[model samples]
Target chain A: MATIAVIDYGMGNLRSVGKALEHVDARSRILVTDDPATIRRADRVVLPGVGAIRECMAQLRRLELDAVIREVGSNKPFLGVCLGMQALLTTSEENGGMEALGMFPGEVRHFTACFAEAGVPTPGKVPHMGWNQVRQTRAHPLWRGIPDGSWFYFVHSYFVPLLDDAWTAGMTTYGLEFTAVIARENIIATQFHPEKSQTAGLALLANFTRWDGTA
Target chain B: MTLAKRIVPCLDVDQGRVVKGVKFVDIRDAGNPVEIAQRYDRAGADEITFLDITASSDGRETLVQVVEAVASEVFMPLTVGGGIRTPADIRRMLNAGADKVGINTAAIDNPDFVHQAAQRFGSQCIVVAIDAKRVSGADEPSRWEVFTHGGRRPTGIDAVSWAQRMAASGAGEILLTSMDRDGTREGFDISLTRAVSDAVPVPVIASGGVGCLQHLVEGVVGGGADAVLAASIFHFGEHTIAEAKAYMAAQGVVVRLAEDP
Candidate 1:
């Protein structure tokens, strides 16, 4: 029995993520837990969160789940979503800058900069809250069933700007193209909420259940 | 390539029963809220909204169960509205697996509550629903005012200005509903929708008054709405969501087809 643990660090929509996992695969045991021991013991670990990055980091550090996340994230199959995706990076421009888990060499930035950098024409809304097309830049197992330009539900102000092309798995454009999906080694993360997205999202969850964290 | 215009189905659920469309449309057993939600999901509704028009407190709890039941099997974004007063109310809806909560009368009563809720639980989840009535006469300048109590009473607040204020206060999206066109099913008040959509940078979802698929297309093209919401047209089996999208796509509106990813 593959016990998949959804890490609850006092942030993110755990119910949807947990239920989405159960909806995709009923055979696997899904546990939405804050217990580090259970997370470490699970075959696959999912880190999902929402809200501000500063508060997210504060809660993670206060609960002392940061170190455990670092450990499990290295050896096991790790999935980061939304704020959890930003938390995995080195630093974030949110809340006057904050240091993060540093599992990856990247920084999170707000939509203000992206909009300003694009200059004038305001690509879209601040919180890109809708179904937008995500073009897959590279092929991966999670992208196996989902099409290249599948529409995913996104509602966020901050995003990880594309730095290294190798790390980018999927890219989406609002006014400018930004990193929508990032992956390296056994880790995968998405700015869009797969659990909330309709069919393609369910397919991603179903794919994740069967994925062994390989490229 | 672009952020497609969303077609959302709004269901006014009461005591776990879908109550709104039944009153107007001659539908067969329109009580199953989850089944309707699932059908909408199948037809490619970008999101599903359940307006909790429950009069009693116990009925409010039933709305949560309806949301939970639909969310369990159907994988789509859900927004819940009606009688959400405090932080506890907001928390209850979000905990029930609702992706967003629509705050209308409460925001009008206390605009600060919108700010507080957004600050506490990011602006992404907070949506301010505006019920607007055309206050300006035919000869006068085009203007709309905010209305409360199902458009029976007027708050005398400017709808466009209120939408700007709510967006400034941290509302991620604005759900603009036209009271005059609401049950009429003529079409969306395009001028009113354009006013709010231009006033605020946040996405505006045009609601109330969608008789045909062309009305949906007009809601996006003329109204400049990010998304369009309707009840009778879809619930009464007039047209499926897929047909609406196809019509919109044919009208040169960029929409996510049910066939595409």
Candidate 2:
């Protein structure tokens, strides 16, 4: 039985994320402790988050899980959800001058100014809440069995600007095209909350659990 | 790019159990909310709305346990409505794990409540549930008038303008239900739905008058609703989630099909 450890960084939807994993018959534990030993020993890790990017990074630093996350992402299956996924980037435009985990080469920027410049209405919104469809960029193990143009729940105003085409697993349109999901080797992350994405979300989690860590 | 249509299942909860009957009477069949919520979750439901039908009569405390149970058990987004009168009620619902809080009568009495809740919880967390009935008078222009207290009293507020006002006042979403069409299993009021959808930039969920899968599709494609919220058809097992999504897919409506459960 694969033992999945859901990193509890004192933020994000903890209970619902755990229930989503359990729904797929996976043994899961919500670990808030920054103890490296427990994370290193787990078969899989889920970094779930919600709120500002700077705040999330600060919490990760406070718990000292930053180094642990880097170590685990190199060799094991790691999943980052919402802000947890955003933290994998280099930096963010939120909260004025805060660095990300620097796992991926990109910056998290706000959707307000960009949407306004494009002449889109309803810009500068704090939370982009509702259901939106994800356009799969290329075939990947994480999106296996999930159909093309599947709608997933989203609630965020800031999104990741991908370094290149290689890092993006899926893209969703909300006023404009935004990176919905990304993947690199053993590390996979989604800007949308898969836990709140219904069946497609559970299928994604199931796929992550069965992944052999081979990209 | 066209917006994707949403499929929503509404659960009318009376004392923590999902109860349904014609015209919202006589608790025909009852099942645990957690059980029904899990079923909807598996069915690829875009969102779930829990109308606490007994909250006002039974008090807010009883509904808290129901919301907590469903929120803890179900993973998808949850919206709780019925008897949510004040900012405190909205706060309690959100604290109980409800992603969105729906307001009806209280919002009608004091339109400021919508703005107040929106200011406090953010517009995304505030949903205005409008229950309207088509007026019969020739001078009325076939408009929808807002109904209050479980659709018992008429507020004479035009549903169309009210929808626009709600959006302007900071409502993230509008759950519009036609009282005449509800429980009738006839079909949704396409014109009414289109009117509201056009009036608001925010997403509009069409509720009431869903008889079959085709009705659900029409609710999305023709009615211009961002999502279709159904009750009796889904609760009575008339059509499973797989069937609905398959029907939707065939009709060119983008829907998340059910996976192997």
Candidate 3:
């Protein structure tokens, strides 16, 4: 049985993420843990987060789970959702500017001026709350069974602007084109909350469970 | 593509069971909140709001269990409201799997509660629920006044201005319900909904008095609401979420189609 460890540094909704994993695969052992040893032994790892980036990082550092995440997240089949995805970037403009795990070479920026600068119509709310379509930038395993242009539930203000297109897997338009999903070897992350994204989201999680970290 | 307008089914839970009533009176059991939430999830409800009518400490414990049950079964954003009084109450709900905490009376008691909660748990998770009643007369300046204590008392705060204040205070969304129209199914207070939605930059979930599918559409188009929250219409099986989405889609309002089961 594949054991997927959902790292619980105590910032995000760990239970829901664990429940979603359980709902997806009954055979897989969905362990919500903060112990570095348990995380290291797991076949796959998930980093989930919500709320302010500064607080999220503070908790990660306080628990010394930051180093564990850096080790387990880099080598294992990893998935990040919402703030988890944001924390993987090099830095975030939130809280004046905060350092991140830098797993993905990019910066998380607020959707403040992209719309106005592009001369597009008035963009939606700041948090960009609710469902929006994700346009797949490249083919990946996680897109299996989920149709193109399918809507996913999103609730965030800051988004990552990827410095390298090689890692960009999906993009969505809120203010302008913002990276919604990121994929590279052994990793898949999304700006949206897959646990709260309904059927399509469940499908993606199902795919993740079966994926071998290949694009 | 444009952002789809949401159809959220609200479950008023009392002591762990889903209940509904007329203007917050004569409450009766509907069904299991978790079962209903899963049904809505499969039927394509954009979100679910579980309002705990019993606001006591014991009630809070019951609601936490209810939320955990529903969260385990349903995979969608769940907003839990009803007696949230402090930042700790909000944190408890979120810890129990609620995506957002809807604050009403407590926010009215200490307006800064909204700011504090939003500041602590990102504004996206802080929703300010305003129960407003139309206070209009020929002699008086027609406006809606905020009501608390289950819509039994008036707080003298103008509905529109209060919404603006809450938004400025860091509330990410407004759950605006018209007291007069609530439970009547006459229709949502489009004028009041419009006023608040226009006043706040955040998403406004126009709630209360949704009698039919057209009201859902009207809630988004006419009321300018980002989402429509209905209780009785959905709870009583008078309307289905798929039916409502189909109705909204036909009206040229973008809505997610229910996945084939």
Candidate 4:
């Protein structure tokens, strides 16, 4: 049985993440924990978060889960959601510039100027809440059952932009084209909430359970 | 493709049972909260909001239980509204598996409570629900005032500015409900929705008074809401969320369909 540890470092909607995992694959052991030992013992790791990037990073650091995330994110079949995805980046522009885990080479940016810069007639919403189509840029194990352009639920103000195509697994356009899914070998992270995304999301989670941490 | 506008079905819950009330009165039992939520989830509801209309303090406890039961069964985002006053209330609902908690009366009473909740729980989970009534007549320029206690207590605060203030104070989304249109099934007040949606940087959910699917479309197309929320139409089986999304998609408004290719 695959024991997947969902890192619970005081982020938003951790329960929903755990419940979604159970719903997707009943046999797999889903652990919602803050302890580093249990996380290391688990076969796979899922880092889920919602809210401000600064607070997310702060909570991770305070709980010493940052080091655990850095360790497992590189070796295990790792999945990051929303703020957890942002935390993998080197830096974030939110809360006046904060340092991230540097798991990936990028910076999290806000969505205010992107609308005008993208030449959109009306300035898009800041949080970028609701369902948006995620275009698969490259094939990965995570994209197994989901179609190429499937809608996923998103709720965030900041997103990682200007990513290298090598690391970007998926691309989604809001006011401007932003990297929604970033993957590097074993690590896969999404800007959208897979737990809240219904059919496609459930498929993604099911894939994560069986994945062998390969590209 | 662009971000699809969301369709949310709201359940007015009173004491664990899903109830349908017209203008917060003439209540009738709709069904079980979990069962209806499951139906909406299968029908491709972008989100679900449970507004607790229970008057007694003891009955209010059932809201958390309902949220817990629904969250366990349903996969979509769930929001719990009604009587969310303190940070503890917000924490309780979120712990109960609600993705977000809607703040209506408490926010009207104290705007800083929104900020405090946002600061503690993160703005993404804090949905500030505004109940607005048209204070201006047909002849007068359109103006809306904020109302509390389920649209009965008028605060005289301008709805647009209040929405702006709430967003500025760290509200991630605004649930804009038109008291004038709420139970009347007249449709969302486009002017009110537009005013609030344009004023605030956060995403606005145009809610209340949805008689048909076209009203859902107008909430996004005409009103510029990021999401549209309706209760009775969805609750009473007048229309499913799938039907609403299809109509919106046909009307050139971007919406996510259940079987989208």
**TM-scores of the models, in the order given:** 0.97, 0.77, 0.96, 0.97
Better candidate number, 1 or 3, judged by DockQ? 1
DockQ of every model listed? 0.75, 0.23, 0.59, 0.78
Model 3's CAPRI class is medium
Which candidate leads the pack in lDDT?
4
Q: Between prediction 1 and prediction 4, which has the larger lDDT? A: 4
lDDT of 2 at B50: 89
User: Which tens-of-lDDT digit does each residue in B1-261 have in candidate 3?
Assistant: 657788999999888999998988888899998889988888889999988887567877999999988888889999999888887888788888999999998888999999988878888899999999998886876699999877889888999999999999989899999999999989999999988888788999999899999999899999999999998888888888888888888899988786522
lDDT of 1 by residue, B1-261 (tens): 878889999998878898664333443346699889888888889999999877899999898898889889888889999999998998888877888999999999999999999887788889999999999989999999999988889999999999999999999999999988887878999999988888898999999888899999999999889999998888889999989999999999888897886
Fnat computed for model 1? 0.66
Docking tier of model 2: it is: acceptable
**What lDDT does model 1 reach?**
0.88
- Which 10-residue span in candidate 3 chain B carries the lowest summed lDDT? B252-261
Q: Write down the worst ten-residue block by lDDT for model 3 chain A.
A: A112-121
RMSD of 4: 1.4
> In candidate 2 chain B, what residue range of length 10 has the lowest lDDT sum?
B252-261
Task: Please tell me what DockQ candidate 1 reaches.
Answer: 0.75
Rank all candidate structures by their DockQ, best first, as comma-separated numbers.
4, 1, 3, 2
Better of 2 and 4 by lDDT: 4
Q: Candidate 3, which segments miss by more than 4 Å at Cα? A: B139-141, B259-261
